[model samples]
Target chain A: MTAHATPDDVKKLAALARLTVSEEELPAFVAEFEAILGYVGQLETLDIAAGSDILPYANTFRTEGTPHEKGVWTPDIVKAFPNREGDALSVKQIIAND
Target chain B: MESNLASLTITEAARKLRAKECTVRELWGACHAAAKTDAVHAYLEVFDADDAAIDAAQARIDAEGENASVLCGIPLAIKDNILIKGKVASAASEMLEHYEATYDATAIKKLRNAGALFLGRTNMDEFALGGSTENSAFGPTTNPHDTDRVAGGTSGGSAAAVAAHTAIASLGSDTGGSVRNPASYCGVVGFKPTYGSISRSGLIAAASSFDQIGPITKTVADAKALFDVLRGTDVLDSSTAPEGSYPEFTHEVKTIGVPRSLLEQGLDPYVVQAFNTALEATGCKIVDIEIPSNKPALAAYYIINFAEVSTNLSRLDGIRYGHAARGETLLDDYLLSRTEGFGKETKRRILLGTFVLSAGYIDAYYRKAVAARSALIREFDEAFKTVDVIATPTMPTPAFKIGEKSDPLSLYLEDVFTVTANLTGMPAISVPMGTVDREGTKLPIGIQFTAPRGADERVFTIAAAVTGEQLY
Candidate 1:
């Protein structure tokens, strides 16, 4: 497939990434990403093995029990946020609920 | 009389310290002075000679003597992402600028126990996200060889610190090509050990599966020395294999691997010339290389990296322990804190990661990336069956201007030659082959070597033989 990724496409990717992109920077990002993506597009033609040999489940242990992935965080630890002054984090509102 | 301790390698300094040729305080002051004058280093902070602190650290080691790790009393630099109690571990991101660490990273604890003084934190890409130090919120680090070009980064400050003699050696986390890339640009040796070879207890998350603390130093011997101390499992980092000592790590080899396919990529002519010269000079046989879907490794890497980062960084909402989340609702704080605290590139990654991992797109993008990654690794396994190691240009080109490409993808491509090793969980290093760009302003090009999963020792030994020196 001889397909080219457009600036709008790249911008959409950037926005999904949550990066703050000025309108002025869009053309530059598009051109540059297009160059790289175009080059990398060659990957579409190659054949790759289908499955992984890696073990996805890592070893984990807890004081109370042994688990596959240890040290999972709990919401109680989530209470440790410094920015949270009350039940929620406090900051200048980014948008108004019109 | 050479008063600059910065000009000396830790190996040399350790010998001097052992011989009583230089006192710890004297060495510390020399290091302190060196750190201050080396402007290109871009160290996030520097410590005053803590005579008492140095004395205290050295006293225990002195009391322990020969049993102590060799890095004792040596002052060193730490990349910002590694934790050091009371100091901030910012990764040069503004969000964590005010955040202080509550404990030492496991490796830092070991180094401290060995009597190494902390010189302060070095600069890096925001959250270790970009290639050039230009992505640093603090500012880009300049290559000491020629300030005009970049000191290839996210670990630029660490490499620059070693190059400018700001620290005898420095600690950096390599995810993709951070350590080796900068080390090559600065004419130093960068070693990224076998995955899980070293602990990552306190490294701020940057593609967790791939990140590992590596060393950057003037010589391979110095890097080897630091590596000796830094290697081994930490209970704190469960990913590591049980602690095992290296007895035959430095044994030399007569055969080296050179991938014609990898080397023939569109490299700068000078880099191409230098790479071939170094390989030919080694007087060793070159073995062929292979990896399936080899071309896809770079693209797969970025996709996987973005997916991992977005998931990992979702925790940094202004509410919890990072920059405050300031939105009326929980989601608002998460969005604003992430948008504000993260640099442009970091945010771009998080969004891409988030999108790729999102429900509708997960299988098409994220899962596809992982599948491609497995294919690449299998290819590496197959190639190792025929060769002891694989060699390629550490980077596609020499150091580019700091901001020549605003496109994030171009920056990601900088890791192309280096990322495959990261993906396969293999050990690799970059040694300065020679200069490529014009002199005075000449930029250093690097040649990389990779060995099998458990064969990090072989890679180092082979690198030592080919380079014909300690890679200073």
Candidate 2:
């Protein structure tokens, strides 16, 4: 129930989130992060009653009937892509070779 | 027509338009003049081609005489987060500062059909991350009532614009009290309909479950009119349900419940007094209600908010149409771009979200928060059965001065009274109770009323009663 975030944990989280946290900002992040976690730790003491529905609803995304055909992606929608090749977004290789 | 057109509510403006007391051009001129008259810093950008847009709307009104929508030729400010076709939808972040919306949001599309005129895009907290517009990357929006203080945010600009009479009414997205917080601070009516009441098709998502687009207006009737146009299902957003998807508010609001536990702690005395006066004016019997979930509500709200924001923002890598930073590799590109593009508060949220959702901490934080959220929803549902509505001070206190709450936790506490509605997916509104003097300047405070899910009408009606306005 003692929730605390360490500087290493902060660094790891930032890395996972694809954010570059400078060394100068790391200590501040650690301090604030620990404070927030401690605040949220109060929830650990909550005794959730049995059979209390946790999820708001199941299959909220599913429709009752047949779905309509989606609109075709147009060239205009691709305007945000930094690099494009023949209507496809260009990306660096996901599978790297040695 | 004797009164200033700029100060007229949406209902009054529409009536005047229909009565030929003022032409659409004249109304536009009045609102435009008022917008230029103030230096609230409410707008990030006012469209340069306002005259052209006004002419187009006026032409439609002229051609469709007797058939025009109430919003026809009525100018409105839009929060920078909601998309207007071909307009820059920044979400007040550097990431999308130059990005143009590919298509209109479903709400915008509906409003367009209704012939609403766009005044401009107003500023907001970067990615709608903070409680005050102070976090806006562009700059903070100042409260019109007191120029030195903040307009409550992330809908600060929208609220300020309405309060200043810059726009007849405006739209803002509320994720954990964005709209209502500012509305209370700015002394205007702010409303969030039942979650999924309006489609989120074009809104830049902050926290998906809690995010809802709502209106900021001078009166409840104006909020209702705008809400009417904005609500409906959208094929693009599965979360939105069709009109009448939930049962309507059929019975009159007769009994109001005040959470006794919440009011006993840390509430400003003047705010409490104003709230009591508003409750007494309602003429409904006030009953003490206990919401056990209220204690843990803020903590749970932030946990879930962080988790969802982290996930939602993961889509903003350098490759897509926002601000892009160059790096040698794709990973480096994402890291550098986000680090540069996001503001301090945005980064803080993303990191917090990532930590909560991370493998080791997921169950300890994210899952428990969801369970706590569900408990809060159940508590709200139980309260609604016994009481027609729940009322509280919209914010613990009125608007704070700029830079007053620099620390994060102090700022998070501002949403104490408003987060429950968002968590429960219920309709809630903040109507001006009256003003509480802060150092000789009278700052407006609002009394918030929360109704059961889909009981949007009930909230509006109760608000009307509290404000001494006739129900629309």
Top model by TM-score, which number? 2
How does each model score on TM-score?
Answer: 0.88, 0.95
How well is each residue in B1-472 modelled by candidate 1, as lDDT tens digits? 2357667888788877777777677778888878887679569888666677788756755576666567888889899999987787888988888777777888898898778888879988888888878888888898888787788888999998998887889998899999999988888889998888788898898898888899998777777888888887667777775544323344445566665666566767788888778888777777665554667788788878888888777667665576875556655655577778887777667756765676765655566667788887777777766676788888888788767866676677678789988888888988878887665577778889888766777767767765676542
- Predicted complex 2: CAPRI docking category: medium
lDDT of 2 by residue, B349-433 (tens): 9999998888887877888888888889988888888999999999999899999998898899889999999899898999999
DockQ of 1: 0.29
Q: Local distance difference test, per candidate?
A: 0.76, 0.88
Best by lDDT: 2
Worst 10 residues of 2 chain B by lDDT: B242-251
Q: What is the TM-score of chain A in candidate 2?
A: 0.73
TM-score of chain A of each: 0.53, 0.73
